[model samples]
Target: MAGVRQNTSIPIPAIIRYDETDKNIIGHEFSLLEKAPGKSIDQIYHTLSVEVRTKMVHQMTDYLIELHAHPWDGYVGGLTPTNGEVTPGPPIDENFGQLPDLEKYWAGSESLESLNPIPSQGFAGFVAFTVGCLDHYIYLCILLAWFHLLRPLPSPECKGRRHERP
Candidate 1:
């Protein structure tokens, strides 16, 4: 993982953990991996310029292609060489056929109601106040413009004119 860089063939959020009970034994639910260093591709993207960013993107695509071509039989369940759950050998979709329960998922939709029953009158009042403030601002601007126009100044060159001295 020392050589791994931004947008390299590596999984995001390197760790995912879950809490469990005695029935679960708590020991088997981990995917310990060869740790990669530095920040994610997102961090790199923010710092890179437009031209460099395009090249970085192309490099990432190439990395993906290489990873896909070479099957990963090297590391099994754990990072260490000896003690790791032997992976089920080669590719097979893990969660392919199992259909997800839609009802349990949709149950969270009820929370959207809290965002409703909004204060319409308060919003209308805010809009009206804003309009009033805008009108006052416009009036002030017009008054200022008129005063500026009316105020007189002597000609820059004082050309072709005589001023009376008191």
Candidate 2:
């Protein structure tokens, strides 16, 4: 978040505070962000003129280019609190599982045995890990859908019935 704010021209809400752990002051862990200007594109995109839509698309593409152009030190996981350093860890949500480690995903055994590990290799390992993670996610989704299908339905009385508001 900090890197995106500092390095890119993308307009994102300024993170006021981030709490990874909760002491329960607010009863939930949360991040406080400065109020962002304007509404969601969903609310107004259909109303935009062709010129405005073209400009929006161009701006979005420019932002993507600017973001991807940032030099990476070869680490492939998400940014860490260690000042943008990347580590093999759970991506976004750990509730699923962690990303594959470098040793596990490395293509060459010689590279794994090397005393001096190159950072560039990290990107390749990360890519392999991401692919495997995606497969795992798909399997999990299918399993979840099957479970939901097999689960007992709610009692008829528990189901909400809509009434006409007169």
Candidate 3:
């Protein structure tokens, strides 16, 4: 968010304070940001005239152009604040937090950080890293599917059978 604010004219709310660790009083990482000065887009979008909507779209396009014009230094990963400067970190996945028992599905002995470290070889390395992660994920999925398929079917009469399809 801070990087976006620094790089673009996008109207991001000012982050008053933030904590990346769960040791704070809140017991979880959180950011406190000043409220951005605008009504919800959903509330006003339907009420907007075609001309107004078109203008809004154009403005959004300009913002996107500004963002793209100022690309990060070719590291394909999330940004973290280090000593008040934004630094590259591991690629963030929505499933990292949301998926239950995610570690069980990981395919290799390598940790996520080891598997997808910040590529020292810049954009080309980032591309290779992305492809490698995708391949690993695909392999894990296929392995899990095969494991399920190869498991013995439960006998209907045997309630204690452990291999029943859920």
Tens-place lDDT digits, model 2, residues 1-166: 6657766778878778766543547644567999888888999999999999999999989998987676655445444455544233333434422222223434343232131222323344556656755765675566456455555666788679653322
**Taking the tens digit of each residue's C-alpha lDDT, what string does model 3 give over 112-137?**
44433334233345567678568656
In candidate 3, the residue pairs with backbone N, CA or C atoms under 3 Å apart (3 or more residues apart, or in different chains) clash, namely none
Ranking by TM-score: 3, 2, 1
Error of 1 at 112 (Å): 33
Error of 2 at 44 (Å): 2.3
Q: Report the lDDT tens digits of candidate 1 across residue range 1-166.
A: 2113222465444433332112245533234455567767776777888998889789888877765454444322111112323222211112211112112323443221122222222223335545644554564455346455554566888766876532
* Residue pairs with backbone atoms closer than 3 Å in model 2 (clashes): none
**Candidate with the larger lDDT of 1 and 3:** 3
Candidate 2 lands at a TM-score of 0.58
Best by lDDT: 3
Candidate 3 runs further than 4 Å off: 97-166
Please list the residue runs of candidate 1 whose C-alpha ends up more than 4 Å from where it truly belongs after superposition: 1-28, 71-166
Ranking by lDDT: 3, 2, 1
Runs of candidate 2 exceeding 4 Å displacement? 83-90, 94-126, 142-166
Local lDDT at 145 for model 3: 70
